[model samples]
Target: MIRSERNPAGDPSGPTHERVFRALRTRIMHGEIIPGQAMTIRGIALEFNVSMTPAREAVRRLTAEGALSMSKTGR
Candidate 1:
């Protein structure tokens, strides 16, 4: 039950990766996610009803953006 709504700039919420990234990024930016919290790919995938690929991508992007910190084991 994904929506196909597009923005004025023609950007649509059509990609699961982007959608997951946006959702996680938003939560991090809004301080919804506690600091030093551990997050797993499988957990995120299950929470968003998406695959591990998208969740992994979102996590990597967030880590790159400094929104999330990775541990030594890359959790």
Candidate 2:
């Protein structure tokens, strides 16, 4: 289980991108998103009710951390 001491929605301690990152990371780690599943920045932004920039940042961070892989086609 992913534990957070702060309430992401109400906490002002972290940036919006960090909140999105933690949420997505937890979902991925918990098997909420299956392997080889299709995901997009637009989809993530919509799901998290955040802007594309934060969504992109979260995706980029996840990719860099080896939690996700991006193909040449940017899938």
lDDT of every model, 2 decimals: 0.78, 0.81
Predicted structure 1, TM vs. truth: 0.78
Cα lDDT tens digits for candidate 1, 11-34: 466567788889998997888988
Collision count for each candidate, in order = 0, 0
Worst 10-residue lDDT window for candidate 2 reads: 1-10
Cα error of candidate 1 at position 55, Å:
0.4
lDDT of 2 by residue, 18-73 (tens): 88899989999999987888888889989977778888898999999988887776
Compared with the true structure, the alpha-carbon lDDT of candidate 1 equals 0.78
Residue-pair clashes, model 1? 0
Give candidate 1 regions above 4 Å deviation: 1-12
